[model samples]
Target: MSGRIDPEFLRFPFRRVADAALHRALEHGAQHAAFRFAHTLEASWRLRDGRPAGTRSTTTTGFGVRVLYDGVPGFAAATEVTAEAAASAAGRAVETALAARPLAVGRISLAPEPVHRDRTWIAPYERDPFDVPAGEITALLADYSGRLGSAVGVGHTDAMLQVARETTFYADTAGTSTLQQRVRVLPEFTAHREDPAGELVSLRTVAPSTGRGWEYLTGTGWDWDSELAELPMLLEEKAGAPAVEPGPRDLVISPTNLWLTLHESVGHATELDRALGHEAAFAGTSFATPDLLGRLWYGSPAMNVTADRTAEHGLATVGYDDEGVAAQRWDLVRAGVLTGFQTDRGSAARCGAVRSTGCSQAGAFDQQPLQRMPNVSLAADPAGPDTEGLIARVEDGLYVVGDGSWSIDSRRQDFQFTAQRFHRIRDGRLAGQVRGAAYRSTTKDFWRSLEAVGGPQTYLLCGAFHCGKGQPVQVAPAGHGSPSALFRGVDVVTTRGGAPW
Candidate 1:
């Protein structure tokens, strides 16, 4: 809502081309058609040990046309932005649809969407990252890394910043038209140390990739200075920490770590495509099959999860999905039962849904849109306690913070996750740091064991930029928000290097 679309992208005759493409598709007897022009910009910087290591920037621009001809779908994209090219792409799309009609699995039908006209929206941001001088950005990262390097007991440091801007213009035969833009940035810093015995230990910032601008790295969104100052001490403590004993125990999982759990367990598991077996080759199928909707006991009564594409600052947040469906929010799990799944127009029609949840997305203009995950988040309890209060309730448990290595089975069921840092909780207080701590549990079992969740104050929005899916492999950004949660009787394991002899 704050930033504007790139002037250069707007300078192109996108509307003229879209009108030409839509007119051609309809004149060719297509029942439905849409045109989209997209422009994307990305910049990345890396620093190691307070020195510049690498820098890169890229820009991509293109337009695509999608058409439904005689109930068969077809798509075509080209980098050329002209009225003639748009018409040509539309003709090719119709031809492709006609050629594939004989092998159609079913009559391609799209869920109905209310037409919107001449609308514009932008993701909230104060400053565009591209406008910032690269040299200035590098200097900031170096200063932060230099502080960590000068810290006692710190051996090395690494820092990086990644920023992206995306602008899109969409038009459809149904009279819906929109122009939108969004910006996102991610900053990270890690500190490393080595024990006298030559074992390595490291601590990295828990700041998640966010839908914000360059201001995020300068302390507008995260407290970088404080976190950087604390990393060295944390890394040193972890280096000498004792190993965790493997056993069933109560655990307090911080939002920093729990967000990833939500992303993998609930976010990906509840995608309609994954649940219905339409998507299997890449991330595997889901156990939350369509047949279990409204019946499967997915978690405790306190558990509630929602899939939202409208959450402010959510990495996957957008005004409209690739299918031209307006962004929406709906429940995936409510009162512990599997109630819904993230959906696109085609998937919604196939699943007997009235409308999509607006999950369709394309990583780039040249790529076809796929049913992608949205901003799936765990709802926080309004009357629940804060993180420290949740920790106080655990008599003997482990406090896990920040996500580390993780693995999940093809069914999105059985899984194990390690943490960047762990603390032994004794008698409702953090006793000391521990190393090589991990937890393993099935998706259903893990959710069922969630006894309590922290209040809104303890909730954090965090996620990854590289959530890979689809057969051709498209990486989409998504956010997962969760509160610090207490899980009862979880199986904690001691990892390889930290095993007690």
Candidate 2:
């Protein structure tokens, strides 16, 4: 257990305001209460046509109070951190809860979790990107874009860099206090070329954002220089790639592309809120009903997926969930079976789980925390063969790398995914690059078709920093680790209706 945040970070105004808010809520007859303060710093840089185009930075700070009165929950937040304002906000929250008491559901009870005080955790990073000059970041992106345009047939290129840092403080009456810091960086670029058929083709980088600092940009998790240099060559190769003939074939899907597929299909479907029919408008409910838990076959025998809130460098890693539950991990799928669901303490208690795994999250001070996703990932098979060996065994297939556009049904049962680069395979060898390729499958069929997984060396952690769900649209950062896996007899589709390349 750890104490609150550093005194330097917690100024007099912020701490005093939060203390006042909690006291006010308690005085207003709140059975339980918690206070949170957060500060986020973010910057974005974009380059187009070998020149700096856009650069921006933003900062936001706020504090919020959550209260339970007569077993009904209420919340209120304020950007202004004055003691008087904080007390008034808490008073308002109590009033709101009392007004809604008549319509309240069952009593609110959070699952018991270990107390963690006098502890501190920070995301791994060498240099803080925020301290760097904005112009320097733009110059780096522009340099990469310039190199991409040097290709003979390449027309234009786009480069982007993003860095973000978050500081959070949590306190609850149950004797828990956690102060945490998180960092993330994302660098991406794209190159486009025109062909004789009056069509345009493009290629993009295959790297993912991570919980690191400027070190990630320079070359920590990824080799930015090498990847930047290879972009032009890969783009050229893709420009001349042939379109695939639609048919069922063996497919090797890379972590770069599988991450997003997991995001849309597996990630959202496992949310307890979605399964319990809470997310109806923003998207339809999931097919993963509570009735299917522990019974549904989610994948092949080699499949294992874990939902984690404490994986180092994972975007969702945190010391404690928004609901004051300490961070934890649990199995979502094991040996092809649905074993668990993403849950908050409330849902966990309702579902009779002994304890919650700390999946609760709120995008901002004003939003109600929900059972958000953690770093859900497919475990690599330690005994499995490597990707190259799997390719050697394939008589015919397509190797899909990186993610492009994707479409899936509202229920997350059916989907079609395109790739940034596709390599055709014939007789256990890479034939060449291919374009106009997409793989479609029902969720069950897709996972069931998975025949083999690559070894740990081929596994990569990749994910988006922004996954949107819920009304008012909360965004959470998440990552997925997976290896290149072979699927048997997946349906392939070719572009039609004069589609753009």
Candidate 3:
């Protein structure tokens, strides 16, 4: 069942409504039409001082209509789930297309694709987190916080859990009908020790968001017991490690820390919208310009990156995108060269491609579908060595693990990232833990500096559940997988107030 697409979701009543809506739009002279019905539930839990601090749950449902007339596209949506409302939406969509005719640069055409109907998918998970008692979750987090914060020099400890379930029904005039259900859970905790004397250090769990369920909280994909046991000790060590001196040195970055780099540099840069300069507002744009698609050197020959829409446990995994295109996997960077772009149906046609990579999405039913990201990841070299082996190749360097404060320019180029913990390496061995360390580099220069990548054993799939973009500010969840990697002498800086304060 893992590789097979299930058709069970069409059994829901929403599918019937979607079918009728699509038919309604096409009957109204729409050259292309799509109907999307979505139901999403989100729950958030926060704990402070061995008790529940806050808890919130939100549920949203609606349907949208998209249409294409003689070379222009328009979209309209309604909260009402009636056939008449859908027809009205289709009518308004045509009006919008006419109004935007002058602004459209060229004929709006979509890449052609074969139709698939009655297909379905459900993200793999054991227990649904939404079904778990909210009180039980809060109690666990509160207990963990209380035990850790009670220690000396500990100022505060906080924990949170976020669970979401999304069910969607999509139908198009081309005879494709797809239904999907996915669940994602994010469990996180931060234990911070602060002193009024201006010293503070915090340690957080490394549990990234995943397409899982309640079992994730208990112990399905993560070992909550072990991570909690080590939080207090790690926090104490970080509090005492010597403040680092800024200088150039070799770097061995763990998968936990490298995932963010992949997200900013590779993930956003390859987005078809960013590449085409459509994301110029808050989401910025891309440095991987169209002219550099096949010629640019993105990284070292050891680097292999892919944009996957079907990765297991990936938050972005779906049966079909909002544009009614099936999911796919395509390369973004291969052997350091820019190989492909993450694209939607319209964007693919604009880019002279034959089909979409299925990167289209709408944050909610009220929003219009736009080019979005998938599970953009750096594939590990299975035949290579592990993290320890890579570290052993360096006589003098720093081993950076976990994530910390990060900053990247609007161009997704110049950036500086700090790590949760830094360990000094001398004579190919870990010497001591160091505090206040950061690394900075331009996007191109940084990736080109890749020295080696660890084997599969060192790979970790990590990502955030909230990647925001677009004018109305739609947030999407994405995943990035990578193995521990080594880089040659890179610019290392200490976060010890470089500017005169």
Candidate 4:
């Protein structure tokens, strides 16, 4: 029920329409012109205690015309899929750029990129969730929920599945054309138990979404059977777990929880636009500015971070960005030193970078491409220990697993993070679980305190499904890969008293 090509999307006369738009813009005295057609499909299915909760599937298809005229960039889009509409939009885009020429703060400039011709890339996956019948999916959700909800000490169960497929076609006047597609899936289930105090204690699956297909939930990527079987007992133990004592202690952070820490502290802080103060919205400007590049000690000597759009199965992986820059991998932090920043064509030109890192991303056809995030990862030490081995080294500490909630300043510096499960580690062994645990530290101090990192086997790719940015607020997916890491002398707090803001 799956195929490598999207016949429905290919059926559209996108090439004919894109050529029309490009021709129109060039004829209208435009210095540069590009046309893009994008189609996105999103599906979600949910169940609560073996009963249908909600289901939705949405499809968005549109085309946009962008032109560089009179030294400024302008963009226009239309839902209509026709050459005439695309040509009209091209003319309007050029007019808008001409009208705004007087108000433009600076003449637009782009970093040089080699022309890419007739390139196509599709993310590797075997099954399309869309191909599965709705009734079959519903039955699967119901069965998973029914098993959990009926378990001992488990009063409620919730499960959900979300999947997306994006198909795009881009053609520019400069002899660059690309057709690309990406598919991703997210599936999760949660088990809840009512404690004696009438409060609900819950635990959720550690596996989040990945750049895979329907096979992800069917034992291709994660083992649902083992997780479901063990969830009820874990929930029962956690419900009666004692509250953690607040103090400075050694901490072992699993990738499930550490990935979010990386996303907040390192990912957003390294966006070149955010650092330059050109754009500030969701997370605000960064503390890691151009002035500190190549000098700032971002972490311990054990730390090495890379921003890449070329990693296999990376959610941000792309063949080419909107600016026609090929995907690349660059160092953001190497041996604890700030080495690079995420850059698009504009940011690369401003920052004296020779080329864009291929990070220019647009969430949809209508949205202007922004210097967005890429798959930022903390590299694992080649010869380091595994998670269990790292845990065995701790005399007294807390092992944090699964992301819970996070609080960080606009600068992405000072932050506190909580986790879904915190186990007390004593004398090289896990004693039991602890409740109401959180770790608080400044971004710099936290990274600098890194004691050790686990080997590749302990690494995991984890991130949020959506990250919001821009004045109009556009969101795109982001990823962070990390190994189980150990940090020394971090302040652990009890969040039961309420948020320690």
Task: Quantify all predictions' global Cα lDDT against the true fold.
Answer: 0.90, 0.83, 0.83, 0.89
Maximum-lDDT candidate? 1
lDDT tens digits, residue span 1-501, model 1 = 388779999899999999999999999999999898999998999999989999999999999899999889999999999999999999999999999998998897899998889889899999999999888999999999999999998989999999999999989999999898999898889988887678777899998899999889888879888888888888888888887888998999998999889989999999888898888888799999999999999999889999899999999999998888899888999978999999999899998889988898888887778999889999999999999999999899999999899999999999999989999999999998987789999999999998988899998889887789886788889999999999999999878763352
**Cα lDDT tens digits for candidate 4, 141-258:** 8887877888888999999999999899988888899999888888889999887788899999888678888788778867888888888988988998888989998999999999
TM-scores, one per candidate: 0.98, 0.95, 0.94, 0.97
Model 1 TM-score? 0.98
Per-model RMSD to reference: 1.2, 2.4, 2.7, 1.9
Candidate 1 error regions (>4 Å) = 497-501
Ranked by lDDT, the better of candidates 1 and 4 is: 1
**lDDT tens digits by residue: candidate 2, 380-435:** 88988888888888898998899988988888899999989889989888888888
lDDT of 3 by residue, 1-501 (tens): 232222333344565566666676676677898888887889999887566788899988788888887788888888777767777887888778878888987887889888988887888888777667766777777877777777666678888888888888888888888778888888878888753346677888887789887877778778887887787887877777777767888999998899988888889988887888888887588899888988999999988899999998998988789988888999989999999999999889998998999999999988988898899998888887988899899988999988788898888899999988898999899987788789999988988999789889988888879888888899889988999999988899878885311
Ranking by TM-score: 1, 4, 2, 3
Give stretches of model 2 more than 4 Å off.
1-8, 498-501
Clashes of each: 1, 8, 1, 0
| Cα RMSD of predicted structure 1 | 1.2
